[model samples]
Target chain A: MLEAIINILSWLLLLAGGAFGIIGGIGLLRFPDFYSRMHAAGLTETLCAICIIFGLVLQAGISLLTLKLLLILLFLLFTAPTATHAVARAAMIDEVEPVLSEDSPRLVDYEDRP
Target chain B: MRDTIFLIVLLALLWLAISGIYKPAILLLGLASLVLVTWVVIRMKIIGEEHNPTVFAWRLPRFWLWALREIVISNIHVARLVFRPEQISPRIVYQNVHFQRPLGKVIYGNTCTLTPGTVTVQLTKSGTVIHALDAKSADSLAELERRVHWLEGETDEVAAKDAGEERR
Candidate 1:
């Protein structure tokens, strides 16, 4: 009974993760601008990666594979955002203007602001 | 010196954890690789307490627990936006972070980016620039800022400034 329960739980998590991945892919194609698409990609980088990895851990049971999967998750959780920030900062520096929802014509200079 | 030792210990544990072999020859190879990597990093002058500042902090787990909850909640929120893209009201905002250390500032920026519906677009000597997909994401950043303040061991700005730790 317990084995069946773990199997079911892992399957549920895997399905949820796959669904999130699909949504993020759709978002990448659908979002209007580069910065917003990052949020979508980030969804996959973080929560989707997390769910799938944790689900796999359940499937792997208590073993070295579980530890490895968790280490990958931890590494992803740290690196993804830092990588995303680097890309965003580079675009901003190169003057990629975001299509804003409001009437802001361009990014205001905050360099001199206290 | 302490940073180098800490990196060595961490690398040794990681090698042991994943190597999955009990042979002396493989262990020696791993140790040699670890030492070589540490020497290269020391030459680069990048490894330091700043990079690993929170490794020894007692309050780190609690901060992580709080950030994890925020991440999950915002994941759901961003998923909702994926279904209804019309609700995406993207805007940029400038935030003044008072973190004295580079690690603290980096963590603040990275955590903002970690949450869905928000990204830390830029970090400079002056301040941090954040882009939020909607209004709530921007508002929640205030709370994240407070939590980061706690993690920095400064309950408030006045206390931090009083300790002569305030810096750009």
Candidate 2:
């Protein structure tokens, strides 16, 4: 009974994670600009990856495989943000201005204000 | 001296965990590689206070929990924005972070990027330029910066000084 419950839970997590991955991909294609697409790609990707890995960990139980899976999750969590930051910095260096709405052109330049 | 031992033990443990082999020859090979790596690390003189800043170690797990919560919250926020693209009013804003250490600044920048709606596009000595999806997201960047400062164990006086400078 317990094994069946665990299996069901893991399947649910995996399906949910797959759904999020598809949504992220659609968002990436539909978003208007680079920065916005990055938001879809980076953040959702991290969550999706975490969910899938967590599901795998549940299936693996307390074993060396679970340890390796956890390590993979940890590495992903750390590197994804760093890679995203690097891409964002590169975009900024290339002078890619975000496409803002007309009414809310409130770019707070706190550095220049002082 | 302490750092060297810590590195050696860590590497040895990692080797054992990864190999999972009990044969004498493989164990000898692992030990030899470990010794070689440790010797190279020592020769490079890289293990020091800067590399291993244990001062903030005690606070890091708590800070990570807070950060994870923030990430989840922002992930939902951004997910909503992705679904309703019209709601996104993306803009670039700057926030002056007063983290005295480069490690703190890097952490702040990475955390900002990790959170969904805002990305740290440029981290200069003066401040961080963040590309945020909306005004609310940009405003939250300041809060995130403050949390990072707290994680670094910075005092309120320094934070107040930075805030005062921004007011000018």
Candidate 3:
């Protein structure tokens, strides 16, 4: 009975994670500029990957596979942010301006004040 | 010497966990490679007080839990914004951070990037330049900065008390 329940929960998590992944892919295409798109991709991708891996861990049970899945999760958690930071830094270095609305003042201008 | 031993033990454990093979030849090979890696690490002079495990031994797990919670919350926020791209008002903001150590600054910058809706674009001596998708996202950074400072062993109450004394 417990196994059956675990199976159902794992399936639910997998489905939700897949949905998130699809949504994130759509977001990547829809966002206005590079920085915003990076936000969409970086944020959702990490969550989606975590969700999917957690589901897999549930299916694997208390074993080496579960440990491996957890290690992958930890790897992703560390590397994804590093990769995102690198890309953002490179973009800034390349002089790519983020698209800011007229209502929202540029950060440089805000820093210059006071 | 301590860092070398720690690295060797960690690498060996990792090999054991992944390989799961007990053959003598494979075991010897794993041991050989572990020694080689440790030697290279020592020679490279990369292992220092900053990389010392003892520095973060107690605090890291708690900090990771807090960071995980923050990540989940921000992920949901960004996911909502993704659904309504019109709501996103992208802007870059500068935050003056006073993390005394370089490692603290790195942790703060990386944590900001890990959280949704904000990315650390640059880290200067005076402050961090962050790109946020909205005003709320930008505002969230101050709290993150405080938590990071605390993680680096700077308690908020102590800082606040010091400020109050300065005011007097």
Candidate 4:
């Protein structure tokens, strides 16, 4: 019964993580500007990774693989932020204007790009 | 010198943890590699007392616990914004660094970036310019800053500066 429960729960988590990932993809095209798009990506990137990895961890149980998975997660957590910071900093230096108000940014839709 | 030893110990522990071998020869090899790496690092002259993150080890657990909770909240907030893009009022604004140490700023900047609603755009000696998803997120950076300060157990810049003056 416990094994069955763990299976169902982990699968549920995995499914939820996939759903969030899809939402994040949709958000990438939907957000109007370079910076807002970052929010969408970063949000899902953090949550989705956590959900999927934790689900896998549950399935793996107490083992060396579990330890390895956790170490990977921790490393990912560290690198993702640093990468995000680098990208944001680069954008700023390149003078990518961010939307400062609610109504409209560039309105340059993703569909326009070939 | 202490940092070099600490780094060696840290690298040795990581080597053992991941290698998972109980052989005398392998252990000796790991020891040699650790010494070699530390020597190269020291020769490179990038080592500093500030680079020693041993102090940070103690402080990280509480900070990580708080940051993880913040991530969940920010995730929900971002999801909501994604569904309703019109709700986002994105703006870049400067937030002051309360902690005096350079490490505090590093941690604070990364923590800000880690949360989706608020990204640290640029970190300067004085402060960080943050691109927040909305006004609420922009304002919340203050609270986040406070938490960062509490995490480091460091006083505001002014007090720290005053203490430094007294030391001199």
Judged by DockQ, which candidate is best?
A: 1
TM-score of 3: 0.87
* DockQ, each predicted model: 0.55, 0.43, 0.53, 0.35
* Model 1 docking tier (incorrect/acceptable/medium/high): medium
Pull out the clashing pairs in model 4. none
How big is the positional error of residue B46 in model 2, measured in Å on the Cα after superposition? 5.9
* lDDT minimum window of 10 residues, candidate 3 chain B: B153-162
Runs of candidate 3 with Cα error greater than 4 angstroms are: A103-114, B156-168
Candidate 4, B11-73: lDDT as tens digits? 777788888987999989988898888889889986655546667666668678778888878
Docking class of 2: acceptable
* CAPRI classification of candidate 3: medium
DockQ of 2: 0.43
TM-score to native of every candidate shown: 0.90, 0.81, 0.87, 0.83
Candidate 1 lDDT tens digits, B69-89: 898899889989988988898
lDDT of 4 by residue, A71-90 (tens): 88888888888988899888
For B1-168, candidate 3 gives per-residue lDDT tens digits of 776667777788889998988999999999899888888988888875554667766667877887878877888888888889999999878788888688888889888998878898888777888889898888888888877777777675535755798999
Cα DockQ of the candidate 1 complex: 0.55
**What stretches of model 1 exceed 4 Å from their correct place?**
A103-105, A112-114, B50-56, B156-168
**What is the lDDT ranking, best to worst?**
1, 3, 4, 2
Q: Rank the candidates by DockQ, best first.
A: 1, 3, 2, 4
Worst 10 residues of 3 chain A by lDDT: A105-114
All candidates: CA RMSD (Å): 5.6, 5.9, 4.9, 8.1
Candidate 2 chain A vs. true chain A: TM-score? Answer: 0.89
